[model samples]
Target: MKKNIYLDFAYFIILASTFGAVLVLGAVVAPVVFHTDVITVNLLIDPYNAGIIMGEIFHRFSYWIYFVAIYVIAYEAMAYKMGQRDAIGFASAFVVVCTSLLFSAIYVPKILSMQALGVEATQSDTFENIHIASEIDFKILALALIVLFIRRLLILRVPSK
Candidate 1:
């Protein structure tokens, strides 16, 4: 990409991630953090009871996918800055989206099953998992961004007068 296009690409990547991440917050992740509807859980974190809460959590991922969105987008900008596109740049974005999709696939049916079970995990555990996953994904995004930024700074040319 051209020098300025690099800037455009960076904007594209970060903005996309932010747009997606913020939407996720609006649509699901943030709302659930504050949700009033509650449930109870039992020993062993049984799938049956855990399903409904899981369902809501799963549903919320649409918004959360943006967690990675921001990182990837920012890296695109950095990639342009450095004049390079390496595996790290691509993998960072890829992992977040792929993991989100993977979690959704498993979480959907599991959540539904909880309805029939008449019980659920303790709210503590449920919330804990949510918090942990949210942080982990966001951290991954941050790390990716840092790597790209550092790489850009390292490789960029200093124009001589």
Candidate 2:
């Protein structure tokens, strides 16, 4: 296998693991720490806001931190194999992921704490913007991966010398 192929595979593996953990860890944590009903109740919550049904806001935020850590590792791996332009792209994605994680980890906790203390927390447009940007990066990276896969296969189509 070519070095770049293996690198890409490793990126996929690690990054996928991060995504999987986000979902799985949240599920596991819900019952173990919060409550069995908490998970179900969380479903009704705004996912960010109280929404009259949401569980502890931090419950969701903790998962984001875990997910971001995963992407940071994967981005670091992918950034190595490409040229300058690709490097910039990977860096941009990494920044987006890192920023999202930062907000999710740092701010989410603060919001949850405020809410827990019965202190009114103000909602801002930043949260929505960050979410949007992170999502866009995720889609772009996935699309790029598909394109790279096709390109690699085409490169391999040449008859053995």
Candidate 3:
């Protein structure tokens, strides 16, 4: 029972941190960086610079996301072994994590490389397609994190003594 309690606590901490990071990145940082007037108008208008800036932001946050993914998977696996039967939530979250990993490691790098090439590279259709894909992936990850957080919250209740 004590072990279960500790595991639950760990799970909550991991989930909460992951959800918080995703929320901040998606809701706060991305919007402020891309939409707000914080960055110079030239940077905002330049596709190459904009892509590099966004990629850098996500690259930094990706480290935290990777750590969260590992912790969440480990905790969920342990819970499954202990007969918690909540693997589905973990699986969904895993998919989200994997998508995020792909975006950060693979897609973002590609965008950065394209940005490095020149402005013409940024204006290409390939870059546009990848950019769209990245946005879609980000939205999917945000929604998945929200759903997982709500699911975990719903499962938690006070014990009847």
Candidate 4:
């Protein structure tokens, strides 16, 4: 019983951290940086520089995401070993981890490399496509994290036999 409670606590912490980070980055930080006139002067001066700046910010943020991914994977694996057979929760968390790894290891690095090529390259069709794909992936990851968090909460509410 104590082990289960500890596992639940760890899972909750991991889920909350993952969810909060994604929400802040997707819902708050990116919108504020891209949509608002908060950085109008910088954008007007050199849009490429602005993009590079944002890319750097996101790159730094990805480090935290990588940690979250590892934590989710480790926790889920531990739960499975302990005989917790919540398949939905495990699968959702696994999706989150995989998506995070894909984004951080593959997409983000590609985007950063493109950003390094300056505004012209970033304006090209390939860059645009990749950017769109990254956006879609990010949305998927965010949704997965939410699902995992909710699923874990539901599992916690159930009485143990």
Candidate 5:
């Protein structure tokens, strides 16, 4: 029981931190990176350069996402083996894992490859569609993380006896 308690705490902390990172990157870092003119008085980063910068940011973040996905899967599997299963919790965890993998493995690599092809490729319709899809995937990923966090919190809550 003590071990379970510690594991639960660790799981919550990891989930919360990952959730916060997702929010901060999407809401804060992306905006600042893409729109340097918003904060600069005399400097303006070109859109191509901004895309490169953002690509690098996501590239680094992809590793974190991979780690989080593995942790989430391992934790959820352990919980299930311990017979502490909830359908919604499992579903949310699945979404979290799938989206995390999709973003880190598929989308990030594709985006980087298109970026390597240069600005013209990124500006094309194909890149635009992929970028839009990635944005939607990211939003879904965020939602899944929050849902998993709340569900796990509720599941881990111990009622007063």
Candidate 6:
């Protein structure tokens, strides 16, 4: 069977890029945004304001997550139809789709709504729990993307004669 190099390459690129984005947002972006001390030497940004800023960032990112979820579903479904199926790859793709949708659809929207309520709402135990759960889900999404990327790479690599 002949493999379409372009499509396969695009898939890998998208998977890798998604993983990198998740890592950067969680590791690099979140800490810097939340830690006003890092960049707010002159201005005083309160916790609530910082939370609002972070919420905006995540809200914008939700669009990208939605796209990635749909793309992953289409790509994986096509691959499956082509008989290129495996347990690990299927599981990883499934994780990616579910986590992506969960983060964009459930977590981000809930967080935004809570933020909209007021500082008091954000400070509540419910907000804290949801925030923590979202963080964990983001981490899981990152892991799944990397796993799927690596597995797809291996599966699609051309054999040497």
lDDT rank order: 6, 5, 4, 3, 1, 2
Against the true structure, candidate 2 reaches a TM-score of 0.41
| lDDT string, candidate 6, 1-161, tens digits | 56678888888889999899999999998888778776877876788988899899999999999999999999998888877887999999999999999999999999999999999999999999999999999999999999999888887774523
Report lDDT (Cα) of residue 67, candidate 6: 92
What global local distance difference test value does model 1 have? 0.49
lDDT of 3 by residue, 1-161 (tens): 33467767777777677767777777777667665456565545444555677778877877877777677677767756755555557766677678768777888788888888988998999999998898788777777777766665555553323
lDDT string, candidate 2, 18-129, tens digits: 4454444345543344343455654443433442123353455457555655655564554444321244445544554654555456655544454554423334455445
**Of the candidates shown, which would achieve the greatest TM-score relative to the real structure?**
6
The C-alpha local distance difference test score for the whole of candidate 3 amounts to: 0.72
Q: Give the clashing residue pairs of candidate 3, or none.
A: none
Q: What is the C-alpha lDDT of each candidate?
A: 0.49, 0.46, 0.72, 0.80, 0.89, 0.91
How close to the true structure is residue 15 of candidate 6, measured as C-alpha lDDT?
91
Q: What lDDT does candidate 1 reach at residue 31?
A: 50
Candidate 5, position 4, lDDT: 71
TM-score versus the correct structure, for each prediction: 0.39, 0.41, 0.78, 0.87, 0.94, 0.95
Off by over 4 Å in 5: 1-3, 158-161
List where candidate 6 sits over 4 angstroms from the true fold: 158-161
Q: Identify the candidate with maximal lDDT.
A: 6
Worst 10 residues of 6 by lDDT: 152-161
**Model 2 CA deviation exceeding 4 Å by range:** 1-7, 13-61, 74-78, 81-85, 119-161
- Higher-scoring candidate on lDDT, 4 or 6: 6
Ranking by TM-score: 6, 5, 4, 3, 2, 1
The local lDDT score (0 to 100) that residue 149 gets in candidate 5 is 89
How many pairs in model 3 have backbone atoms within 3 A of each other, for residues 3 or more apart or on separate chains, i.e. clashes?
0
lDDT of 4 by residue, 17-135 (tens): 77787778778777666654565554452556667767888799789889888888887887677666698997888789888988898888999999888778899999999888888
Clash list (residue pairs), candidate 6: none
Question: Where does candidate 3 have its weakest 10-residue lDDT segment?
Answer: 152-161
Give me the runs in candidate 3 sitting further than 4 Å from their true place. 4-7, 35-45, 158-161
